[model samples]
Structures are given as C-alpha cells and as structure tokens.
Target chain A: MSAPPLPRTSAEPLVPVLAIVGVGLIGGSFAAAVRQSGLVTRIVGAGRQGGTLARAQALGLIDEIVSLQQAAQTADLILIAAPVGATTEILATLQPSLRPETIVTDAGSTKADVVTAARQVLGDQVGQFIPGHPIAGAEATGPEAADAQLFQGRSVVLTPLAENSNASKALLTRLWEACGARVVCMEPDTHDTVLASVSHVPHLLSSIYMWQVATAQDSDLRMALAGTGFRDFTRISAGSAEVWRDIFLSNRPAVLAELQEVKAALARAEQALIDGDGAALEDFLERAALARRLWGSRSGLA
Target chain B: MSAPPLPRTSAEPLVPVLAIVGVGLIGGSFAAAVRQSGLVTRIVGAGRQGGTLARAQALGLIDEIVSLQQAAQTADLILIAAPVGATTEILATLQPSLRPETIVTDAGSTKADVVTAARQVLGDQVGQFIPGHPIAGAEATGPEAADAQLFQGRSVVLTPLAENSNASKALLTRLWEACGARVVCMEPDTHDTVLASVSHVPHLLSSIYMWQVATAQDSDLRMALAGTGFRDFTRISAGSAEVWRDIFLSNRPAVLAELQEVKAALARAEQALIDGDGAALEDFLERAALARRLWGSRSGLA
Candidate 1:
C-alpha cells in the first residue's frame, strides 16, 4: 500500500491521524487541544476500558475509538497516556504494528523509565518514541474532565532520545506549541530527577500526610476543622492513585533521594522545636517563606 | 469610672467601640467584616508598627490607631489578633485599663496557648477573655489583603473559660455570627489538638518541603518545572514566618505529636517503595485519595 508522507513541520493539519491511549485527563485534554488547534484531522483513542474511549469520543476529544494495534498501524503519531507502569506492555503491543514513519510520544510523569521501556521494546525503532510530560493536572480525572484549554500556558517537557530524528523533534515541538504549551527539551535522567523533587516526591508526601490525618482517632473533627490551607496542601493527594503509584515506583531512586532531603529538613525543624530555639525556628521558616513568596509572585499565582 | 453595660444579645450594633490589636489580615478582616455587619460602631487598630495601623486605618478597617491601654479602656470588645507569642504582653497591657464589662477575645490559630497566656495575665479577669480561633486564613497578609467577606461561611472556635459568664459567651457568639462565621464551642486543649492535626502541622510540613526544594542543588530547574500542584502544596509555606514560628512554638506539643505521626506514615510509604510493594503503596494512596476527594466534595471546593 502506498501512503502520502506525513508533514514534518508546523503546518495546518500537522497530524493526519493522531492516536491517544488511555483517554483520561491528560490524554483526553491532548486530543481536545490538538483538535482545536486544527493540527490533527482525526484522533483515535484507545484505552484498557471501552467506556473511557467511548466517553472521549462523545466529548469530542477523539474522532473514533480504536484498538492499540489499529492506532499504531494507522496513525502518524500515537500518544500513550496510560499510567507509567503500563508503558512496557503498551510499547510491546504497538511495536508489531508500528510504522517506521509514526512518531510515538507519551505523557508519563517520569521520563527515564518510559524511555527505557521504549528502548527495550522497540529495539531499533526506539527513535520513534519521544518521552514527554505535560506539567499540568487537576484533581479531577477521566474523559469528562478534559478541556481544550488545559495546556494553555503550561510547560511540556520532551526528553528526546539520541536515536530520535530532528524532523520528528521539530514536528512534536510545533504540535505542542499549537496547543499553547511551552515545550522544553532535556535529558531523560535530568527530567526524572527534577520532576522527582518538584512533583513526584511532593505527591508522595501529600498522600502520606493525608493518610495520617484520615487514619487519626479524631479524623472526623480534624476534617471538620480543616480550612483552605489544609485543603490546598492536600489537594495533590486526591490525584489518581494508580497513576501516582506508577510514577513513584518508576522514579523510585530520585524520589527516595528527594524524600531523604525532606526528612533532613523536617529533622532540623524538629530539633529547633525541641530545643525551644525561637530564633533558629524563625530563621528556618523565614527562608522557606521568602522563597515561596518570591516564586508565587514571579509565577503570577495570586 | 463607671460605664453602661454592653449588649449581650444578637442585636444590631452590638459593639459600640471595637478594638483590633495587630490589624493584619485576621484583625483587619475582622474589623471590616464586623463593621459591614453593622455590629461595630468604631474599630480601633493597634499594632507594634505604626505603618501597619495607619494602613489599616486608611483602608477603613479601623476608625483610629490607639495604644493598647486606650483601646482597653474605651472599647466594648478587644480582639488581640497579634501573634501568639505576643499574647502575654498584649493581655498584660490591657489588664490594667480593662473595663469590667469589656469582652476580650482572640483570633489566634492555637487556643490552649493563648488561653494559658490570658489566664496568666488577666488573673481574676480571665473570665472576660474568650479564647477563640478563626479557622480561616490566606497566603496574603496585611491591611491590603483584608476582605469583608473573609469570614463568611467560615468556622470560629470559642474556648470559653469556666470563669466566664453566660452573657459574655452569648455576646461573643452573636458578634462572630454577625460577621458571617459559624461559631463552635470546644475546650482549649481540644481546639489545639484538632488544629495541630489540620492546620499547624500541615503548615510546618509545607514549609519544610518548600525549604528542601528551594535549597536543592538544582533548585532553579526544579522551580522552573514546578506547576500548579507544587504551587498549591507550598502556598501555605508563603505565610508570615514570624506568625508560624509563634504558632509552632505555642502549640509545640501538639504539632510535635502530629509531626511524629506524619513521620511514621512516611516511613511506611518509604518501606513500601523500598520493597517494591506496589499493592501496599496503591492501598495507602487509594485511602488518602478517597478521603481527600470526599472532603473536597463535601466542602464545596472545586
């Protein structure tokens, strides 16, 4: 069969057909945003469950529901938006049907593990896979929560492998920019480590904190008295458990290293409290407060 | 000098002259809210810094900037909204000029510590001090951030002393209600424990996390990659360092206990990660996610 080559640059209808696996918040939003940008003519969604794909289609996030094999064989690009734990299996399943011209990327929170999975499964075709993470999320999940504006003013990091072609990198960059995301490229290891500090470990700590509060003897009263501070502090704990679980396990080393640092920081604070050193405690708190305030102001967060 | 008795019911203009010491966010907002409720005829602001009091006055949160002694002598009610560490000094200053009928309350985050200070300084007049904790705050502080609707639909815990009269309790409850807060009564120790679990410990943990991230070797890259989740998780860390230092010290016992529990919870998570126990990790995450989601939905927080 003879097929026309897909466009390799920023042009209208950049993707003739785009496939999105696991049409949850990230996947569904990607489909919606790309469709709205007029970069993709058709979006085929695949997932472990049929209901999610159907919902994505109904919500206009996708043009059709298709099998992973069908998506791999037919689409110019396939985005695996499933949990990071499923990356290996998804890559294996798609490898057989993958077209050499198809450029596959993922929206996993961790990059190094995804890249390793792609290399192990795709072998010589690893160049087709670009590990990417969109630095945007919400407490809400699933197809119903997808929004076209979800990627607006958000950061999307791409960890391109050495085997990846320049054309594919340029095309993927252009496509994400079309969705209103600022795209940054970095090494997979660096991406994993940086994300571990900012995202993965924070999520782990928040979940741990929430678990402690929920399991306490007076959890009912504690919950009742919890105000905006607790609400915001624990907001990330309400994220998809399976997704976060995979992220933590996949980036275990970096996460553990970051967690150790956090423990050290807390121990210093504990020491200050135990010694009744008001000046030391104040100094510790003031440093964090000042840093947080500067970041909040610079980031335009109210 | 003899003065007429203050109204002890939910009547209009309940406070003829209200004094708000340390007119920062809490005190300034209280002044604005009470004045809007038509419960306070005039609000006198006092703080360590003249600029803050002047700003509060200019913002119309208070009618005048007066000394603590003057406020104690002239006001129907005095709200010591200064830092918990300053509670003893403020109460001591007010005790000498205190009018018998004047109701003294506070808006401290910790109740037991504030109550202890009030008892120490007010002596026989401890009954006049109704220890209260407003379960509301914002990352922003100062007079400029004052909002009249800040207390609307919020909780205000009152830990009335055994020496207190029913009339004083009734008047304080009525005044808080007029400011659009739901007043709940509890023991001072209970208030401290509950708030330590929900507020104090969480603030400490958030600050610790922020400090760790800010002081990391690749902090610039990590901060650049930080998104909404990090922003929300660390928002409380941006709160006034001096204010939080006082809270942590004042409620040291409860906060330390809660921090111990959090460390235990994190240790369990660390063990699961080390053992590569996906099942245990998933279970831990699922419980917290379910609890947080339920609370978020119930609290009408989107």
Candidate 2:
C-alpha cells in the first residue's frame, strides 16, 4: 500500500498480471494489443458470458480465462472493460478479492457514474481505481471484431477521481501508452461534457437523421438511391444500441443541452431559407465551413 | 432547327463547337472532361470575368476563350455550369446568340429554377435546354481544381422539363455519358426533393453541428480532442460556402421540410434522454442503427 519498491533491474519488467473483464470489442482489443506488445507476462479475461470469454481465448486475445474473483486475486492490473451499466455490479463482485496494491481501471464511455460506483464499492481502495476511456471502436461489436490497432493514434482520456492514487494513475497511463494511445487527463465532468458534444451527441444525431430518412414515405426508393454521402452521414447510427442507450441515459442533461444548441442553429438555417435570404444562408454556411475546416486541419483529419 | 438530320455514319460525329460558361470548378471540369475525350472538335469558354476565361484556357480546360455572344453562336453544344443564382443572368446574355439547333443544358443543382429561367430567356428554344446536376465534387474549387475524371463513376441527374424533345434529352445524356457519368432522369421537383434529403440537409446538419462545437466553451480543447467521427460528420460542412448557400436558397422548401423532420427526431431523442427512458433510447438507437445498416448493406457501402 505504501510507495511501491522500484523494479530491481533497469530492464522493464513484464506486466505481472493483467485482467480484462467482459472481453468484447474494446476489452478484447485491449487484451490483443497488450498481448501483441509482449509486455504482459500473462493476460486473463473474465466475462459473465462463457461464450465471450471462450471466444476471447480462442482468438488468442488472452493467455487464460478465469472468474471475477480469480482475476482480482491474481491481477496486478484489473481492467473493468464492460458496458457502463454493468460496471457497478462487476465492481461489487471484484472488490472483496482485490489486493491493496492492485491497480484498477475501466474503459467505459461515461465516467461520472462509474467513478461514483468505484468510490461506493471500494471506499479507501478506490485510490487504486483509475477511471479511463479509450475513444476507439467500430460499428461491429463482439470479440470477433476486436483489433490490436483499434486504439492506434487515438486518445485514451483518464478521469482520475479525487481518491485515485498518483501511482495508480501513472500505471494506468503507462498501460494505455503501451496500447498505442495518447493519454489525456481531464476531470470526469469535463470528460462527460466534451464527450457529449463530440461522441455521444454525434451518435444520436446520426441515428435521428437516419431514422428520419428511413421513415420517409418512399424510403425504399431513397435507400436505393442513397450514395456515399448518405452512407457516411449515417454510418455512426449503426453503433451498438444498448451501449448508446446507456450513454444517453447517463449523460442526458449534457446531451439535451447540446441537441438544443444544434436545433437552434438548424432553426436559423430554416428561417433563412423561408425568408429567401441568400446572403444570410451564405454567411451561415461560410462560417460553419470555416469552423469545420479549422477543426479538420487542427485534428489532422482529411 | 425543325429536325436536325441524323448523321449518316455509324460512328457519332464530333461536336463541331462547344461552349462552356462560368469557368469555375464544375464548368472548368466539364470542359476538361469533354476535351480529354476528344469528342468535341473545338471548345470555347465564356465568363463575366475575363480572368476566368484566361485561367480556364491556361489550365487547358478549354481550347479558346470567346465572347459570350460568339461562343453561343458557334457552339453545337452549350453547357452552362454556373451557380444556380447566376443561371438566369447567364441565360439572358446567351439567348440572343443561341443558334436554333444548339443543344443547351446546365449543370446547376436546382432544376426547377433553371427550367424557369430557360422558359423566360429562351422561350421557344426552351426545348433545347436540359437541367442537369452532377453529384460529384471535391472540397476544392476554381478552374485549377478542375479534374477531367471528376464525373467518373458519379451519377449525373438530368431533369428535362415537360415537353422537352427526346432528341435533346438523348444528346445531353450522351454528352454526360461521354464525360464518364451514369445518367438518370427525374422530374425537376422530384430531383430537388431527393437532393434536399441526401445532400442539402446533410450539409446543413453538418454545418450546424460544427457551429455548435465551435461555440462551445472549451472549443479549442474539443477541437483538439475531435476524432474521425466528428471529422466525417462535418466533412460536407467544410465545402464551398457560396455553393452551399446557393443550394440552400434554391432548394429552400425541401431543405426546410427535411430540417423540420430531423428536428422532430432530435427532439424525441432529447425527451427520451431527459426522461431517463433507457428502453426508449435503446429502441431509437437500435432502429436507427438497423436502418442505416440495411441501407449500407443494400447500397454495397459496407
């Protein structure tokens, strides 16, 4: 529990034990990335569904599969990589077996609720819990869709709650770095707000937009004629429904505020069109285009 | 003028003269694409600004720069590729010199407006005017950005106003085909409505979304943290402001309708999130995701 002794030798010691719970796309990808790096001596995966755990091992994403208690007892690093809604129960189950020096982290999108759950379950042991989110995924779900390079060139934001220890935070940062992610530090609330604007709100907007198109009177014909523009605009709408549901629920206020802001902008555009104000429309489009170009250039995206 | 004699040869005869107006991206690209095919014996360009003609010829987008009257008098095929707002004025200038048998057409986004303009300016020669829109472009603009292959693998939608001559329609279709585009026919109103849904509305949404992000309190941080999701969502928002503004003005009604529908969907999502109705949120996301996947799968986008 005290400051951990430094490794005896200069050579980087292998990750003694890394446990990934709920080995789906994110978790499975995490295990795969770590295993491929050869930095971990052993990677163990635990999932409620036996099929998922079996599939993770079969895909060579993990060195072994174990129960929650077993993984907590053995792992120097415990990664709770499950759905946000499942985190509380998983934390409760693993708390009893967790050791004083064990470092725990999560890859959940919503952070405030998860941090609260960790504090409630582990109390003083919450110091070992470093909450993190890896902003990488695909339209596809399941362990079969996991890729070692999923996190490459992407960010993994860590929201270390007040109780989190510096040692635990540093170790978690190292793990994310080893997985080829750029680590960022942000408060949990800030993380939620930023994510609502960038990730969660975009997903919802895409879904809502697609729903509007799909429900059109001549949807079949429209879908038939839909090309690259429509395809890309609605691509994120195809993300996992359950995961998004939990995210929207957890981050409702921020999401709603963001949506209202977008709606106001849309209203202004609609009003300009109704008024036949070409100059106003032009100005709006020009401003928006300039902002988007600036964002794209800054983000290093085409 | 009554009935142009069909060429008596198996091979299609080269177009003796071609006139391209505007000399911007679309106009210049059309000239380049036509010249590259060697289907036209001579290509002439006309624009309000002399510099555009010089730039078009300098960039090899056309063989020669000519006066609007001269280009109109000499050309067998006259292609207008100016912004929708300029179509009316361009038609007025070219009408006095339009040869009786000239096959005239436009590459404007809005067909109904162009058709209206043709009816006013060309009168009896309205039959010679075909309204077309090429559904292909890059973010870049100007004559220098013109590409001969811009229309390759892209759809060129033609709206031949009621009572258009079959011969005129056939000639325009052939011209687009020669330029490497698949041509499709639709009513002017239908074309406008479909484009509003697939193109105009998406642009508005993307722009509005980007505007919202730009106005956020932590705009810089959010921009720095933005990933591919935000990039793709806002891709169209980064296009030419003037062009998009004209599109919004020209297709005002349809864009407004689509915006209203999207707003309703966003409102529903907002309500669901506010209520913390996880089931409703999941259902909305699931249906949207399913619809998108179905559309993507059918369109071969996946």
* Fnat for the candidates in order: 0.83, 0.68
Q: What is the interface RMSD of each candidate, in Å?
A: 0.9, 1.5
List model 1 lDDT by residue over A89-198, tens digit each: 99999999999999999999998888878889999999999889999999899999998888888899998888988878888888787789889889989999999988
Candidate 2 lDDT over residue span B168-249, tens digit each = 7776676677788888888888888888887788878888888878887788888767777777777877788877887888
The Cα error of candidate 2 at residue B156, in Å, is 2.1
* TM-score, candidate 1, first chain: 0.95
In order, what is each prediction's RMSD in angstroms?
3.6, 3.4
Model 2, span A1-302: residue lDDT tens = 12344343324545789999989999999988877666677889998889988988899888898999998899999888888988889999999999888888999988988888888998888888898899888888889999999988888999877777766776676667778988998888888888889988888888888888888897775665566667667888898898888788777777777777777877777788899988888887888888987776666666
Q: Which stretches of candidate 1 lie over 4 Å from their true place?
A: A1-11, B1-12
Candidate 1 chain B, poorest ten consecutive residues by summed lDDT:
B1-10
lDDT of 1 by residue, B1-302 (tens): 11136554445577889999999999998988888777778889887989999898888889999999899999999998988999999899999999999999999888887887888888898999988988999999998999888888888998888898887788788778778888888998999999989999889989999999898888889988899899989999999999999999999998998889999999999999999999999999999999999999887653
* Fraction of native contacts, model 1: 0.83
TM per candidate comes to 0.96, 0.92
